[model samples]
Target chain A: MNNHVILDVQNLKKYFQVGKNLTLKAVDDVSFQLHEGETLGLVGESGCGKTTCGRTCLGLYSRTDGKVLYKGQDVHLMKGAEKFAFKKEAQMIFQDPYASLNPRMTVSDIVAEGIDIHKLAANKKERDEKIFHYLNLVGLNKEHANRFVHEFSGGQRQRIGIARALAVEPKFMVLDEPISALDVSIQAQIVNLLIKLQKEMGLTYLFVAHDLSMVKHISDRVAVMYLGSMVEITTSEELYENPLHPYTKALLSAIPIPDPDVELQREQTRIKLEGDVPSPINPAPGCRFKGRCKYAKAICSEQTPQLKDMGNGHCVACHLYNQ
Target chain B: MSKLLEVKNLRVSYHTYAGEVQSVRGVTFDVEEGEAIAIVGESGCGKSVTAKSIMGLIKTPPGEIKAGSEILYRGENILNYDKKQMSHYRGGESAIIFQDALAALNPTMTVGKQIVENLMMHRKTIMVDGKEVKLTKRLAMQEAVKMLKMVGIPNAEQRAKQYPHEYSGGMRQRAMIAIAFACQPKLLIADEPTTALDVTIQAQIMDLIKDLQKQLNTSVILITHDLGVVANVAKRIVVMYSGNIVERGNARDIFYHPKHPYTCALLEAVPRLDLKNKQELASIEGTPPDLLAPPKGCPFSTRCKYCMEICCEQAPAATDFGDGHEAACWLHHPLAPKDDVPFKTEVRHE
Candidate 1:
């Protein structure tokens, strides 16, 4: 969307020790760049480390290796005042609205939490005005200011969460499946609000979700991850129209289109992925998806494939596409 | 076609401190033999309540099914069935599988044992040499493993010996399906069976359900809020809103020619994958109405764009669109405004 790079993630890896001899590679060898004022969608199935990647990029989780740079400043290396400024500049909107916000606190206080932490407002009068402004921005009224989290519905609570993130006036946001917990009718409402807010504020987004349709609609570029590794990254149109990776094709085929006619045509051509995603703990070498891949050969299980650009800025990591 | 199950004027309400919440108000539909129909609606729209009412899971202390309600199973009214008769009808004649497979399954019992228990309750005896004998546990366990393998769970013997937590989300759902079909019931109610799994796993489970339905020839009623999911699986679709059936038709009819504004709005609200460019989603403006004192007219009138004055005054009766398709909306009335639909809906006759 822009020439300026807002966030650059380089070979980021985040691991956890599950047992005495087991290590879970949640985010391994994942790298991407988020341009200024652009929404980059990170999509994968559950437990594929999309959420872990987003959190690691936001410096929420300590990385095991590599660096996350926000506007050329390393996010993990920053300490004291620099880290506080980075927090104010980049906010995270969590997945569960019911758990993200404090249930006992009023809506105004919940929205003002970021404002208070960043000292964006000086006095009580200024804080109230800022809170009301953000409330109205996210389509809430003044009457909801004093109401607790339990009094609102799931959609309204998600709006409250968005308002809290907007209160800090962040230039970038990491939305971790913000609409997954919401109902279908309510999901479009939040997506529309996010689109409008990004247009009005010129905010960059690192949208992490498993919903491919929503990702295709809202993102300028899309990245596909599998078993804690990015398999493909390209423009949204190119990625959806011509997916080069085998896992990406399978993931796209799995999504059920809401029309019977389309489903009738797709049923025969659909790729049925067998079994579940392999456990990420102490994973084997070579391609992580080789176990389920149809075109996996001897070379796929022997060596890991790196992301290779296939002209026009489209990158894919797969042994089948090796040239 | 014979009707496998008929729900007539089913009125279910919950008495709370505030008022009586009409969870399912006079819902009526029929599941023909060997047919697959989906009940699609948003959360709090009473789809789950209707399923629960049919299953007789409503607790009477705070919940009540009003008089004049009838749930006919194989031409008999099950609402009047006694405890022993009801228990016999529950797993023996009809079965239900829930959304959360982990919670619906027992944590302490092995997967095989659960299936064995269901089989023992429903299928107590088998005929051998023209004589009925009591089913042994060993025989039931063998049948349970066979049922597990039938649902596509590999290594069935070893997996059956493990508990529910040991199985993954899709596998647990498969085990649940195995138990539900073990009795060979006439009707199966799958309530959001794949809602907890991801898209890939969801596709696998949906395929499994489709295969099993054909194999057992059992009528299925799928309840879920996602319209995208029901398209491929359900033969007919029932669109519900605020405890009322706004529209019901064959899958193609509903997708091509949606009569009610709520159904049309739901179709346009979800973003489509086939569309290439970024487009504005036509989302509904407001939330569903509170069911405590339900609206007198159409429940979707508050959010409908073509809301006539008469719509707020009284509820519209079901207007038939032929071929067993019907929708309850004022727009279809002859005296109402003509050509009021904002979107051009194609009506293709096959």
Candidate 2:
């Protein structure tokens, strides 16, 4: 991990109108920074707006407020050549392999889509060479190039997706739950492939996933989201070992340990959250997790807690540490 | 404990245009009166087929349960049951819950109505107001509210009246569990029940299921691909691969002293949060075998690090270690060389 910040997201918000008067707060006041060659994991439950945050950061969805600075330039304000260069500098690997790629397109065309759009290759041979190079980089061979997308398995299709993302030679990539849809054995394979590629290409990643163990394994830092708001952010080790927020503690404790011995010997109190997450539409001005938190007090419902920096760069947005 | 359900020599095949796809082959297992047995494997390993066969849920013509298979439930062969008898056994004696609660539930009707219908189908009479009465819709609705509250659904009276689409994901799953357990079935089969929920919600649902199982003494057969879930909830685990049972053991034995190479690879592949040192996950080399024309030998032979000549020549028999732990691998054979431990990928240095 380097000190150079590749992407700086400040107070980003994305809202959707569900009805005539309702506003669904998808990504509200989320902020983070992705350093060069560093993997920053964004973790939350299904409706926690982690994916929306990632999409908003990558300019896939226009931000309702705040700014997304990609190397000190506002992504929302870029135009013409600057926008094209930004597209080349940033890419995304989608979550679903089955739905992301077109079944009619061959693997070669899919991998070369970015290359063709950017016209990185001077001749047909150079394009073919680049396609084969990315395929090999993602553990696929030149033989797999001519085959259609439907002919490949889930893991193979994901590799094709990676190859497509890498074909652009992007400096920053947003991988939105890249391995969540895969099987366990295949998940490790994909993770290893990503690690190998990151090391070789010096790519920075904003990996969004629901799997905590996988996030801890691959990320230098992690941020926990709940109901469209970031609850905690810190180094992966410190976040896992000494989580500050009650929601993070509950989430970490809820993860089932694979070892029987550890599971059997675990005597810690299970922080069972009481109710489901409150609806994000017209949410109250308070902690989003207050309804389910065990230690919530009167002040928690009166005002929203801000993400405050503790020592050693650990940050938490909870009323427990307000003093 | 007496056996509640026993499946013997169970072979199921699907007929397609290409050939007969052997989805499940000679699967044998038994669930004790109150035991929780988990059948764990990746997709297409036939764990779901086995679970569906137990409930007589497999669709024939395209799929068929082969001859000489016996599915004995409570000392009676349910495989030969007629339609009416099968229906009676399905919800009254045994029930299955699915992962996707919305898909499994009736969307048009209120959740309470669904539970009441199930209860009325399985139950004949209920005691109401200190008198024995024929189970009426009103009485059944009362019971449904009780069931809803039992599953930890808050505001059960109001929530029970809403349709399935109105409830959240975790709540819908809880409602499904309430419906499944409404009949008080002797056996419950949960097919990846928590796979669709978040971790915290998954933990809550698992705890609820365990509590209900203990309270009702209902035998459970949990089919999942997650070994971590199995370790935490299940007592006995049967690891399957390409329609074959590769290993069966108690949770402790399976996790700590795995015998099969596939099991070892699976254990090593999972990233553990308890470990102090972070290391790269060691994954198995290839995908599961294609069931259309599965290998004549061991199904995992193609990816086994300990693959030998005989592994491809013939299928290995299940070698029983003590305490009901068994593994089907050439390494466990008596004639195989000793000191040949199952190999795992080396931990990464950097």
Candidate 3:
């Protein structure tokens, strides 16, 4: 219960009952803490439950079990007003800007929606001011406020999404692959804008993405997830420099280097994972990665490994590292 | 080295209500037999247009091939070919794999039927023992299964019966690849095939493309914005900006020692795993200029960090920068007067 800890999730579990008795463990036993004014990057491949985890954390989807502690308070146990206050404190930025924003609503209405719901604005003028303020913060001009979502470009729409998230004056935001839908040239602009806003507003973020390079660039600490579990978590530099988990290593190796000379000269020993990822419904006993892991042993299939700290705040979950 | 496909000064424009939007301007490049070439640029940079032009897929009326456009496939002018001739060239000589697998594929038809259709249409008719025999449906189905297996789609026989919607995004892309490779075309044009896929799936598709190209000995034209995706895949790189080929060279030369200012900016703009600390990513300010009235000088001059006065007034001719590396910029022009101004230090990222 540290004040520095803006949001802390303990053993979060979200399971969907597929059949009469079977359950699909979308997010099982996932734990992480987002500190004040810091970005925690959650990265994994598609269907790895990163999106589910983010949505569940935002209270959009209720967690089947476990606790989401916000500023030392249990969010699940909070009553009407308390939950409403928590909603104001934490906001989410969705992946697709075009779909996330209502097409019928103008930029002003879209951004001011949160403000209207929370009644944060004193009057119409104040609501307009707040909308423009957040818009300017995200690098959008006043003229863009009147335009609809369809009129703006992808990057601009994402900015409006960010502005909508910030309209509530949230201390922490869940950025779920915000830049993935944007162009490469515009990605840098958005990232920089996020950094500037974080610095100015003292905002904390849970930045989820599949792009390892961009995640490493923006995040203070990084967590690697695979098949509904946190496989590794460490400082951004440490995670990229010395990845401990086998899955993490494979994922990093698969990233194509931009420099062709370095790409060619570098021995690309791709750890070709055999077969597709196993289904989440009734997952096999022991390690989830045992099927694809090259170094997996009999012990790996028999017992699941817990995330253990290697050193210097680097935590990895693997039987190979346990020895 | 024989050139498999050569495009010279390709100019494609779309007739819009506002004006004629010139999509591609004087794009020239060559793909050697069995070599992979990449056209790298941002959206609206004419990379896709260049690929569409090569495939003769550019829709006319709105899109018209202006003068000074030449597309040579195996030393023959494909532009001059009629629709029937182009159809023969399409699935038989060269194939294109588009970005959206779901959109490109026929959702109602089973993957097997789709592949079989291409095979039946393109597979050369043969005679056995002085007796002509048409290809049977069974033979086409067998070839379709073979194509699926070649692209590494497991349980090909069963999966082939399933429609495109049943297949995952990666599998659909693989199926698209199967269709493209059914006839074993000499040249393959993959226009951002991995853009819609996840990184892992993207890697898989890229690997499949590379492996197939090697096995078939087919040249590839990879058009994409992701620099990393094209890093090891392409032998040569052509950097495009505002409908013009700004720089062209071997992949190694372009990545290691980029000559054009736009190329250098693009390389620096991309976030890399190797870069430590949040150094300012070099972003080219402003969007690409409108192609209808493209600037007289370098197309990138408006946003160029090293823009000179001469660059704004007159177009910089293509200048060779050793070892087949060339760039179109006033800085490289010998006759242009040198400026004392240094490159702009506008830090893009924090």
- Per-residue CA lDDT of candidate 3, range A195-262, in tens? 88888888999999999999998899999998899999998999888999999988887788897767
- Native contact fraction, candidates in order: 0.78, 0.70, 0.61
DockQ of every candidate: 0.86, 0.78, 0.62
Off by over 4 Å in 1: B127-134, B343-350
Best by lDDT: 1
Candidate 2: lDDT over CA atoms? 0.91
Please state the Cα-based DockQ of model 3 relative to the true two-chain complex: 0.62
lDDT of each: 0.92, 0.91, 0.87
Better of 2 and 3 by lDDT: 2
In model 3, the fraction of reference contacts reproduced equals 0.61
Which one wins by DockQ: 2 or 3?
2
Residue B85, candidate 1: C-alpha displacement in angstroms: 1.1
Task: State in Å the error of residue B83, model 1.
Answer: 1.1
Q: How close is every model to the real structure, measured as TM-score?
A: 0.98, 0.98, 0.93
Q: On residues B111-204, what C-alpha lDDT tens digit does candidate 3 reach at each position?
A: 9999999978887553446765677888788778888998888899999999999888889999999999988899999999999887767888
